[model samples]
Target: MKKIIFSFVTSVLLLLPNMVKADEGMWFLMFIKRLNERNMQKMGLQLTAEEIYSINNNSLKNAIVQFNGGCTASIVSPDGLVFTNHHCGYGAIAGLSTPEHNYLKDGYWAKTRAEELSPKSLYVRFFVRMDNVTDRMLSVVNPQMTEKEREAALNREMEKIQKENSEGGKYVVSVRPFFQGNEYYYFVYQDFKDVRFVGTPPENVGKFGGDTDNWEWPRHTGDFSVFRVYTDPNGNPAEYSPNNIPLKAKKFLNVSLKGVQEKDFAMILGYPGRTNRWVPSYWVDQQVKYAYPAWVEASKTAMDAMKRHMDKDKGVRLKYASRYASTANYWKNRQGMINALTAHKTADQKRDAEKKFAKWASKDANKAEFGNVLSDMENYFAKTNQESANHNYLSIFFRASRITPLVVGFTKQLEQYLSSSSDQEKEQIKNRLEKNLYAYYDESYYPAEVDLFADNLKLYAEKSSSIPSELSQVKQQYNGDFKRYANDVFSRSIFTSKINFDQFMKQPSAEVLHNDPLAKIATALLTKYYQKTPEEEKLADTYAKAFRKYVKGMRDSKISTTLYPDANSTLRLTYGTVKALPADKRNADVKENYYTTFKTMLDKYKPGDPEFDMPARFVDLYNKKEFGRYLDKDGTMHVNFLTNNDITGGNSGSPVMNGNGELIGLAFDGNIEAMAGDVIFDKKLQRTIVVDIRYMLWVIDVYSGAKHIVDELNIIQ
Candidate 1:
């Protein structure tokens, strides 16, 4: 989350301690077995025995779908009816909805296929092929080359690869190194540019319990949205077209009516954003103590401020929902991680891992290199900690308000003075500003951000003693009065000062930007101290070299493992058994299950509490025994499934496939107990929770009467 190299290494290294000698010795064997297991049993996967015969075999086809778009989805119908998580399409869905048609609150449904709303920009990709070109790519660069030289060489190599493989097309192709640097794969994708909205349930249905219910099991959230991918007259990817044809996928998943039963193998395939399973204990401790708590507190402060502001202004609430939700997500996740670490033996396990790494390094033939690497890493961690804190503080401040735009404009003016630019470049700068201007109008754009910044400032002030001396001086200037500082910094008007930022927008941007409090702070920080800080320059160079080295090292040491570093944007595959394990040492006996009944939902409800109250539709469904076609093997209706398949943020829309490779469910969230899976993947604690596809179809058929959509599914039942 912090984007530190130490955290990245720690994520992988931490797992090493728990692994036995047999696990290490049989890594290659187990890797092959696991690959075969995934291909045979996982979602949209296919592999032959010959493909798994050896690691060197290139017969296995690429199993993942690629997309220029950010999220993943599955084609449930031959007509190209795509299903993904609601949050995955929230931006587009929200973009198309307004006060007169609040799709988020009331849901959206097209009477006919033609009535589907075409989004401004939406697309999906399918991976056509992948070639192992690592050796060829790296052959252009010397192994002993400097980081800068390697980078320059890599750029040229990539340019050549892209030109040759692109085939004069707009398709996105990326050459990714695997196994540290021991292998390479060239991924070629076919992009479908035309995608449109079909349907989405209301937030009450899709998001259901909101922040409280997120990442928790017995989840009632439907979490489904429907979209259609359209193609041009030539049946190729294209922009929005009134007469576009439906794009048919070469490998689309068939939605299975036979849902997951107990211990049935389930696998998820998509771009799992990130996991920091290899982080050091020091980093983990820092996160548990400082980073997470700061995030939670800041989010709480901002949410409270937004609620107060929104209570008197509906327009403001609508505008800020996205911003509020973003903060709330981080806050909720941080809290979950805190709870998870407390519940589990994460800290103890991390310590054990450090010891194991040290032992292994002693016996390793590359002991000197490994020892130096570890020491360098530790030294880097210690040097960067304070600077990292400072960076976080500044990032939070900049992101919190419109001061960023003003600063950007100021920087552009400075750049223009410093360098001569062509007419095309000048136009690009103008276009970029205009684009950002539209983004500035969003409700959460100003008020929620300002509040978050103000809150973070308070936290920073409290933690000032721990910060670098230079940054501490800046924090001291703020003292402890966040509200006072916020008023001075962000207030464009009295109403805006109170968090009703929509009211403040009545004043022009110039009026606000000229007198805004943060401008002065920005000016002072940017001009006088921050821009010239030795620590800043040193850290920047360090990170630059580190990144280049990381890329080169990955290219050089090609170690093959099923586990891949999350790119935050790319499709991924995760495979594991469904095991109900304890949350932590404190709850050693409690094993998580796939489903929680209506009985469990009712037990948690308090009649008079607004947060706990079930909506009438949900109550009616429960009371009427109207689960439709969603009964599991035991004849009980299921709401969610808790699996051991490792997943995280970008995995929102991933399909949970059965061993037979049938679509059993859609993965949307994980249990709160497994929130730390991003940093330290505890198979014992982490669980990828999915919305049972059976329940989804049941709701569509019985509840919404959208059986036309259901008719498209290839249901076994």
Candidate 2:
């Protein structure tokens, strides 16, 4: 969610005399600032002087823990109890429950350590250290090389780096490019293969108002989950084992009672996904006018059909809640962004900036690359702009249905094939496939998806008449004749399963064999008047190249930015400072701060309103002012905090640290205003939200009465 700054007034400056040069320089300055803001600086964060001194003096890096196999987390206890967001551990919790044992609905608690539930597959990872390997790695690649040559060189460099760093174990090492092409960090991490679920609250508490309250503030969703890591008899990471011992983290955060107050210094460390701050203005306008709106409409239509089916089918709802929630969440966020973008006049500003840059580049030789790239991007957008929105929709729906599952299945099968001699591989593959099957069966509607494609075909037919009168008759022929279309197109395919798909791929004319249901729909839309069109393939290749170029450009630019490579199951450290800021145009004057009490929660309550109803447990806790042992720095109530840390999807369970590196909170959500933080993060507006460590301990001590687990924590009150 990159927020673009667009101002129409600035657009006119592009044609102005002296102002054009100033505007061009300002754009570059902005770009540099953005890059520096997101760059990794080891333990260094964007903190105030006092905050920096605090973390440098007191922070304990070992407190951070990777959780439940995939997500990031931090350990609060020495005996193995770990803390992370409820959403991070939701899948495992949801997976273990049946209709009768609806953990998601009623929640679950292990009364004793012996009764704690073991997840079939869960693990945690811990970061060891980061080493500077910029020159050592990039020395192998020529800077002036082509994209393909650069990619190959990078791959070779990474292989060498991994080999040299390998400890002759299961540890993974990754070389990450940072600040565009200016720096590189090599990270080594050990991933624990065994982790187990400990506890979670009911949906009423964990999810609270569900989607209605997802990204909103003054919130009361107790988004927390508990899990424990286990090691084998030899103290080695392994699969679930009864004989396994609790993991002893090299570093763990001591639980703190002093919580964040207004303007408190805080920071979050986690992996954040993509951002689009550097995109051209034309691209931004296209997304605003065409891309986001079209997808939202398509998603709405699909959701309606899915929800209608779910209402009549309980099994479908139960199995597809995760999928639905994922889609619904995106839909909500995108809508919010659309509104915010318009309010901020982002598109207009971007257009103005682009024109100014172009004018400046016309004179400057050294800075010509900036304007040239901008021009290329705009040209590319113009060529593919009309089809881009529909392309995304097609990709999403089709990938959700067929491609993703195939890829996952293929990966699992490959792992199994490679480990044919190991019995554990077979067991792991079986478990993975079983879970995937449930996911695929629950969320995918093969017949309905095909029908949706059929509908899209007809819609395209109606629209294609505007393209050319020569193809008008052809468009009319397929306007309502999907039955014939499907038979003639899809029926010619042999893409039923992996085996068939693989066989088709091996054929000399494999492209001809790709006439599946999805392809039929694509062909109907792309081709005009009985003539085949290569537009689809051409657009696909262009997009692929664009993405690759973007990645390559980041690697070569040497700009200090956080646009790093993906996590290759390796340990990495990210640093940023914690600060509260206004939510851009919406709450520009109001400071985003901590802990809206039960009082604030109650104020939003409407007795007859089912959506706003508080659960009895929450109400009771509120009435009791069950502050328990948790209290803020000022001895007032505690809730959440804002940090200027950059993070992403994989950073779910990451630790939020103070300047001293002590664990103050567990990083969870970013403010709704900062939804676009992933791309073009704004230090002024972006803040990572976290559940206070004090609050977590209070729940364990006062609510669950899990003193045994509580005793494990080194509580620093």
Candidate 3:
């Protein structure tokens, strides 16, 4: 262990000074002191590296957490007040909403702690510490081993390391691979499961601009939500209970009401999701040519199907609101990626870089180790490209089959109940299955399921190269008429209706399940997928091995200077400066000032529109010019600002701190021109959109009249 630590620290110390850019790289916190502290200081950082990340004492890392494994959040008050993006909290908010109250549309404010609502499941995990265990992990791996053998050996060591660090499950420990298996890091986290929703602006303010303004610039969405973490009286992780008290955080960030100006230093601290900046051009071709188009089409199909039901019934809207948002967001994102990647010519750029790398590696010693890497990757991609559309279309259809999951879950228990001779045991199993089926029904309503099922079948036929042999008869009988086939199946399938499903479960039997149309589809499709998995996995392994060698060779040849690992939802620091964008380069209609104001946001408002409607009180306040101290000196309320910080998916809700480590804004979205950013960071065009902290405070104090909640925060002006 000591040797591993020493080797990791030495490697970190050897990092080249000028290799990394101030505006690029999602850096690990552990090496901040040795590698980034000086550069960060020169860029206007005020705190020491230890103050940013330390295991023994309170530091900035304590405040930042992985919110539910998907998004990032920060501790803002000593009472465990958590701050994250509105869309990040949308699922929980939608779950708590109803047609009558509609907390999502009207927004909600907990005036007191007692009024805060807890979702059925919502949690926040604090970063405890991290250790680079690369050497230790590689000790069990060797070139002679097959991929499966290497994986098994590594998993054994990881399990032991994780268990040792878990402290009897008190802390969650995970070891994630980085740099294409070239490095490994151990992350420990403590989760508090008693988080409750506190306050959120109405969707008008929170998600303003909606789909129309999704990735566009000059952004004015508030995009922030509030929650609080609660723990046992002893300040340990605990489930939700009335007796649980608000967690007294070891450290919390103070909100800086003094808004950031253009050229002001901006740094983000959070768990960024992933970036594929080093991918080969061949894979990029696959994504652009085949994979993404299929995903975009299938996602749009699901979104439209859900919207048809949601728009007509308010209850359905509340139920499927989050689903529609998630589907639409990604659908648009893929479309944007296709356009942006083509316009930016990212594949061409990647080929150019690869050419340079090849020239550098032409020498004898380098050639022996890395010569076949690029060729092997090319071969793998060439083969996979043929099936890309088919794979994605089929995969999407399987996932869009919501009730299929319930059927699978209930199938195992039903089989058990059938085999049991004891009446008591059989009855118990039946009871368990019924309860869970009901729960799944509520989560995925019957109307939505029927629509989604029909949509999936229609899309699968439209895009997939071949139909499952089991379903071929049905397809042939209908003469490939998807609508007719869908209607017939949905009408017969018990899975589409809750009452029918429940009644059928009362006399559950394998014969009935085997005959069921939905079950047959799930079984046929899943079996077909698994049957092809071995070959598919072999091709994937080929890509993985080649990429790993390619990355290592690049490092050895000095073709790749900065070697920061891609994000795997781990804590990282991305620093840059608040900047402006050229809205139009041809005519230069707008230079896109760093800040957006309420007046501009109001200009885009449309009455009674789901995306643009705001409460009358908010408009009234604006008309009266009821500006508080939160306003700028020019008497305008700043809504959003732009920064050049390097970030991606999970960085949503990350605190955009100033040079002084004070919260200036919450990093939310990236500009549209930089939609190709996940593949290649365009330093000239990429911009991180942030909700100015003052806007959040103004809505809390003046709009929601939740000054008591505001008083808890350490507000710095």
Whose lDDT is greatest here?
A: 3
Cα RMSD for candidates in order: 7.1, 9.4, 2.2
Off by over 4 Å in 3: 1-17, 421-432, 533-535, 583-592
Q: Please, what are the lDDT tens digits per residue for candidate 3 over residues 8-122?
A: 4566567646566788889999877877888888988999999999999999988998887799999999999999999999999988888897888889999899999999899
Could you tell me the lDDT of residue 42 within candidate 1? 42
Candidate 2 steric clashes: 36
Question: What lDDT score belongs to each candidate, Candidate 1 first?
Answer: 0.61, 0.56, 0.84
Model 2 lDDT per residue over 1-717, tens place: 011123322332343332221101111111222332223223343433322212223334455655644567777776677888887777778677776787766677777767788865677766555566767656776536654576688788888888788688667787776433434667766778777777876666666657787776646566788888778877778877788888876556766666655544455544434445655466666777767775666556456545665666655555555655667767777776676566566667666655655555455652534434554565667876666565555444442334322543444364454447776875676556546544544444444434444444444334322333422443466665854554443344333233444454345242443334434433433343224257644544444344434444433342313233443333334444545555343332223444544455566665445346655665677777777667554554555555666565666667776545567777666667766543345456655666667766666666667767777777766
lDDT of 3 at 440: 67
What's the best-to-worst order under TM-score?
Answer: 3, 1, 2
lDDT of 1 by residue, 338-382 (tens): 888766767777667556555555556646434444444455566
Ten consecutive residues with minimal summed lDDT in candidate 2? 21-30
Q: Which candidate has the top score in TM-score?
A: 3
Structural similarity to truth (TM-score) of each candidate? 0.78, 0.72, 0.96
Better lDDT candidate (1, 2) = 1
Poorly placed runs, candidate 2 (over 4 Å): 1-59, 66-71, 140-146, 179-184, 312-315, 347-371, 399-593, 605-611, 631-636, 643-648
